[model samples]
Target: METFADLVRALDTNTKTNAKVAALADYFRSASDSDKVWTIAILSHRRPPRPVNTRLLRQWAAELAGIQPWLFEESYHIVGDLAETIALIVPPDPQNETPLGTLSDYLNAFADLKQQSEAQKKAYVFKHWPGMTYYQRFVFTKLFTGGFRIGISQKLMTRALSQATGIDEEILAYRLMGTWDPTSVSFKALVLEPQLEEQYSKPYPFYLAYPLEEAPEKLGPPSQWVMEHKWDGIRAQLIFRKKTLFIWSRGEELVTEQYPEFQVLADVLPEGTVLDGELLPFPGGRVGSFKDLQKRLGRKKVSRRLLDETPVILRAYDVLEWEGADLRNKPFHYRNQILNTLLEQLHDSGQRYPLDGSPALEIANWESAALERERSREKHSEGLMLKRKDAPYRVGRKKGDWWKWKVDPFTIDAVLTYAMRGHGRRTNLFTDYTFALWDENKSGERELVTFAKAYSGLTDAELRQIDAWIKKNTLERFGPVRSVTPHHVFEIAFEGIAFSKRHKSGVATRFPRILRWRKDKSPEEANSLSDLKLLIP
Candidate 1:
C-alpha cells in the first residue's frame, strides 16, 4: 500500500512523458504480481461508479485545507489545476514510513510473479492490506483508476513508452493502447501487435491520415491527387479472432453487438485477421444520410427494423493486417498489394468486401484533379486524402505520411430572422440566431430562404447586446425560439450544402456556424437567390 502511494507521488511529480513512462514501466516490472494486476485493473477501469450524492471532493478538500469552497475554486486558477491543489493540501510526511525507492523495482517485482497462479496472487493481495484511510482510498482510486485524468493523456503514455524502451515514439504508439495484463494473452497480445497483418488473416483498408504541415502545396495540379469523399462516420477496425468477431471503433469502444452484421462477415473473411475502414449505413444500395446513422449510435440493442433498414458496409480504404503478419512497417504501396490480394481472396471465398463495382465503395485510380472535379459536383464530400505508396504506418499525427485536402468552406450573407435562448452558459441570452438568404420572385419581390442557422462566433458582450436588442424588438414569440424583425445580417459559414427535399428552400447547410455579423450590410444587401444557388454543389 505504501509502495502504491509512493508510485502515485512519483507520478504526480514527474510530468515529462519519458519520465512517467519510465516510472510506470519500472513500477510494473518490479511490483508483486498481485500489485501489478491491481494497478492494471485500476488503470483500465479508470473511474469508480459515481457515488450516490456524496459531497463534491473539492468541497471536502477545501474544508481540510481551511479555506472556503469559492476561495479554493478561485485559487484553482492560480494553481492551474485541481489535483495539484489537493496534493498541496495533503503533503506526505516522513514519520518512519517505508519509502519505496524506484518504480522499476516495483514493476520488476510484479513482472517476476507473472508465472504465479491467479488464486495464489488473489490470496496474497487479500492478506496484504496496509492501513489506508477513506481520503487516501479516494486519492488512490483517482490515481490508479485513472479517474484523476489531468495533465496526462494516452499520447503522453505512448511517448513515455518510447522514451523508456528506446523505441521510436511512432512505433511505440502503433503498439501501445494503455496498460493491460500480459497474463491475459487475448487482450495484451492485441495491443502488442496493433498492426493489422499480425492480428487478422484478411486485409482491411484504412485511411492513412496526413499531417497538415507535410501536405504538398501542389501535387502536380489536382490531377495527381486521388480524391475521395471524407464521410462523417465511425472509423472501425474489424477483427475476426478465432471464431469471435470484434468491431472496435477508433474511440476504442468494442461495438460488436451494436453491429452484428459485420460479425457475419467473419464467415467470409479468413480467421485471425483485422480490417480497417469506415462503418457507415447503407440502405437500398446507396450510402445512407448521416442523420440516418444517428439512430444506430450508442444503441446497445439493435432493433430488427433498424438492422434491416440501415445495414452497414465497410468502406475499405487500406489494408493493415494480413495472414498473421504485421504490415504496419510496410509502405502504403506494399500494403495495397496485400489489400488487393486479400480483396480478390475474399471475393473468391464468397465473402463480402467492397470493390470497384460494389454499391458501398467508390474505388478508382488516384486522381487528384478528377477528384476535385467530382467533389465540386458532389456537395456531400468534405475533401480528399493522399497517401504515399511506401510510407510506414505511424501513430498520432505526423507529417509527410498522410494528407487530407478538405474542400473550402462555403459562405453566404443571410438575414437574422429569429433568435433563441441558449442552453448551458448562455441560458439568459438569445444567442442562437436563425438566418435566411433572399429568394427573389419573378415579380421583383424577394422571399427568405430559411437554409442556415448559427450559434457561435459572437463574444459575451456581443451576445448580451444581441439579447437586449432581441428583447426590445417586438415580434411574434414561440416557446424557446423568438421571431425577430429581419434587421441584422450575418455572414454564415458552412461545409457541404446539400439539396434537401424536406427543407423549404430545397437546400440545407452542413456544419453551419456564425463566422461574423455583417453589421454594415442591410437585409437587402445580403446574398440573393442566385448566390445561394451558386453554392448548391
Candidate 2:
C-alpha cells in the first residue's frame, strides 16, 4: 500500500508526460508482480467494487479524529474530496502502528467485504488507518471508494510497461482489451505469455481521430483520402469468432445481449470476422434519430414491440479481421474493398443481414467535402470522417491517419440562473452554472426555465470573475447550490438538440458548453424555449 501510494504521489505531482511514463516504468520494474497487475487494473478502470459506503467511512473517521460529524462535513465540502479530508483530519498512531500491507493484500481483503458485517467492515478500516501515512491513507480511502485516479492513460501505461518488460506496446494494448479478470489472471499469463484462445472474445483498442481544426484543403489532394459521414450513434465492434458472437462498445463493455438481433451473424458471418462500425437505429430503412436509438439502449430485455419500433443496423466501416486472420496491418483502402465485397456477397445470398458498408462520399476536392459536411445534419450524422487511403489501422488516438471534421454546433443566448461550487481546485469557487431560457407561463407571463447546465469552456480569469459575481449575486441557498440573480448572459453551444419529456423545458441539448460570456446581452434578450424548439430537427 505504501509503495502504491508513492507511485500515486509521483504520478499526481508530475505534469510532464515523459516523467509520468518514467515513474510508472520504474514502479513496474521494481514492484512485485501481483502489485503490478493490481496497479494496471486500477489504472484501466477495472477496480473491484467499492467495499464500504462513504457515509459510514466519514462518520467513523470523524469519531476516530475526535471531531464532530458536522465539522467533518464542512471540511469535506471545503476540500472537495472526501479521501483528502479524512486523510488530513486523522493523525497516525505511532505506538499502535504496524507496517502497511501490500496492494494485492489490501484489494483482496476489500473484495471479501461483501461477506463481512458492518461492524466487521468498520473494524477492518480501523485496523489499517493507524499504520499508514497521510498520502497512504488517502490512497487507501480512495481504493475503498473505488475512485483512485492519477491521470494515467492506457496508452501511456502500455508504453511504460513496454519499456519495463521489453515488449511491444501495441501487443500489450491488444492483450489488455476486454473484460479480463484481474484477480484470476497472473501478470505473466496476461501480458508476457498471452494465450490467443483466451482473447477470442476481446475487442481491439478503438482507433480514435482528432477533431480537424484547419480547412480540409490543408490535408492535400482529395484522391489520397476517403470521406465517410460520421454517424451520431454508438461506436461498436461486431465480433464473430469460434461460433460465438460479441458486441463490444468503445468503452470495453460487453453489450452482446442488448441488441440480440445481430446474434444471427454468428452463423452467417464466417468464423474470425471482426468489423468496426457504428450501431444505428434505422427504422423503416431510414436512419432514425439518436433518441430512437436510446430507447433500444435503455432496455435490458429487448421486447418485440421495441425491436419493431427501433430496428438497428450495424453500419460497418472498417474490417479488422477476416477469414481467421488479422488484417489491421493492411492499408485501409484494401481492407475497405474486402469489407464491401463481403457485405455484397452476404446480401446476394438472399439473407436479410443487419449490416451495411458505410458509403464514401465522391469529392473532386476539399470544397466539395465541406459542402457535403453541411448536409450531415439532414442525414442525421455528426460530420465527416477523413481517412488516408494508404493508412493502416492504428491503436488508440493517433494523428495524421484519420480526422473527424464536425459541423458547427447549434448556439443559443441564455441567462445564468444558478451556480454551484465545482470539484477539485475549483471547490472554493462557483465555476458550475445552470443556464435558462425564457418561457411563457399559462398566464402568458414570461419566466426563466433552466434548460442546460455547463461548467467548461471559460478561461481561468473568466471563471474567477464569474465566481466573484456569483458570490455577490446569490439570492438563495439550496445546500451546495446557490440561486443567483439572472443577469449574466452566455452563449451556450451544443452538438445536437432533441425534444425530451423528462426536461422541464420540454427539451434536452447534447454536450452543451458556454461558448462565450455574452456580457453585451441581457436576460430579457436571451433566447426563448420556442427558439430552442425550432432547433430540434
Candidate 3:
C-alpha cells in the first residue's frame, strides 16, 4: 500500500507520458496479484452513477463534505467540475487513503485481470475499501466503473507505453487492440505471437489524419496524392479472431451486433486478421446521408426492414493485417500492395462481402489535370488526402506523412427562422438558431432546414445585438424554442451536404457556420432546395 502511494506521488508530480508509463509498469511488475486486481477495480470505479435528482446529489455532496446542501450548491457553480470541487473542499485523509496514480498502471493492471473471476475480483475489491470517505468512494466508484475520464488520452497512454517498453508506438497500439490477460501472460507473450495466414481476402485500409495546424499547400502537388471522399462515418476496426466477428468503433465500443451485415464478411474474410475502415450506410444503392446513419447509430437492435433498407459497407482504405502478418510497420506503399492483392483475390472468389475492386471505391494516385477539373464535380468528397507511400501508421495527427486538401465550401443565403436558449455560458442568450431556405413554388413559404445552430462565430457585441432581436422579434413561444419571422438573411457555409429524408428540406449540412450576415439579401433571394442538391454527393 505504501509502495502504491509512492507510485501515485511519482505519477501526480509530473504528468509526462514516459514518467506515467514507467510508474505504471513498475507498479505492475512489483505488486502482488491481489493488489494488482484491487488497484484495477479502484481505477475502474472512479465514476459513480448520476443521481436521479440534483437534490440527492446535493445532499450527498453536502454530507460528504460536512457542509450544508445550499452552501455546496453555491460553491459548485464556482468550481464547475463537481468531483474536483468536492475533493478540494474536503481533502482526503493522507494517513490511510491511497492517492490516484498514473493511467498506465491502471490500464496495465486491468489488462492483467482479463482472466480473473468476477466473484473473486469483487471480494478482493470490497476487502480493500475500509476507512475511505464518501468522496473517496465516489472517486473510487468512478475509477472502477469505467467512467474515470480525465485530461489523459489513449494516444498519450500509448506514448508512455512506448517509452517504458522500448517498443514502437505503432506496434504497441496494434497489440493493445488484442485481448490479453496481464495477470496470466507477460507483455512479451502478447507481442511475440506468430502471424497467422489470411483465409479470405478483404480490404483493410489505414487512414492518415492531418495535424490541426498544417494546411494542404505545404504537401506539394495534388497529383502526387491519392484522393478519396472522406465520408463522415464511424471509424471501425473489424476483427475476425477465433471464429467470431468483433467490430470495435473509434470509441472502443463493441458494435458487432449493431451491424449484422458485416457478419457475412466475418464468415468470408480470413480468420485471425484485423481490418480498419469506415462503417457507412448505403441505402438505395447510394451512400446514405450522415443524418440517415445517425438514426441507426443509437439503436441497440436493428429490425429486418431497417437492415434491408439501410445496409452498411466497409470503405476499405488500408490493410493492417493480412495472412497473420502485422503490416502496420510496413510502409503505406507495401501495405497498399497487399491490400490491392487481397481486393483482387476477393473479387475473383465471387464473394458477396462488398469487397469488389472498383475505381470509385479505391483511392490511389490522382491525376493533376483530372483532379482540378473534377474538383468542383465531386460533390460528396470533402477533400483530397495525400499520403507518403512509406509512412508508418501513427496514433494521432502527424505532419509530412499525410495532408487533407478540401475544396472551398458552398455558401447559401438562409433566413433565421427560429431560436433557442443555449446551455452553459450562453444559458441566458438565444444562440441556437434554425435557418430556412426559400420555397420558390409557394409564396412566403420557406422550409426550415437546420442551416446552423451557432453559439459561436459571433462577437460579444453581435451576440448581444442578436439576443435583443430574438427577444423582440419572437412570434410564438414553445418550451425551449421561439418561432421568429424570416427577416434576417445570413450567409451559411458548410463543408459537406447530404440528402436526408429525416430533415424538413430532405438534406443535412456538416460543420455549418456563419460565414457572414447578408442583411442586404431578401428572403426571396435566399438559396433554395435545388442549390443544396448540387452540393450532395
Pick by lDDT: 1 or 2, better one? 2
Q: Which rank order by lDDT, best down to worst?
A: 2, 3, 1
RMSD of 2: 3.8
Report the C-alpha lDDT of model 2 over 355-391, residue by residue, as the tens digit: 9888865568888898999999999999999999989
State each model's CA lDDT, in order: 0.60, 0.89, 0.61
Q: How do all the candidates rank in terms of TM-score, highest first?
A: 2, 3, 1
Q: Give the alpha carbon lDDT tens digit for every residue of 1-537 in model 1.
A: 566666666676786766776777676556655555445444444343322112344665576557887777655444544445555653344352444433224334445534566555443322221223334433542542234553445555545544544556555444443333434534234333456633332223344576344334444333333344565568877777667677767755556688877655666666556666677777776676565666789787898999888877777666566665667888766766666676777778764543321112232543534455355335344565566555677765676656766666788899988887765457667788888889867787888867877898888898898899998994996645688888988888887566677888778777899888899999999997578878764
Q: For each candidate, what TM-score against the reference?
A: 0.55, 0.84, 0.60
- Model 1 C-alpha RMSD vs. true structure (Å) is 11.1
Query: Could you give candidate 3's per-residue lDDT for residues 1-537 as a string of tens digits?
Result: 455555555665666767677776677567655455444433323222321233444455476568877678656554444544555555445464454444334444544544576555444344333334544444543344444554445555556545555666555445554333444454444543422422222223335577324544455654444544555578787877667777777755456678888777766777567777777778876666666677678577899999888888776667687767777888877777766777787777875574432122223334452364256334344454566666776665667776655566778888888987765467667777888875544566556555455445667688778889998998997745798888888888886677666677777777888888786888777887777787676
**What global local distance difference test value does model 3 have?**
0.61
Say which prediction, candidate 1 or candidate 2, comes out ahead on TM-score: 2
Model 3 poorest ten-residue lDDT run: 194-203
Worst window of 10 by summed lDDT in candidate 2: 194-203
Give me the displacement of residue 207 in model 2, in angstroms: 5.2
What is the lDDT for 133 in model 1? 36
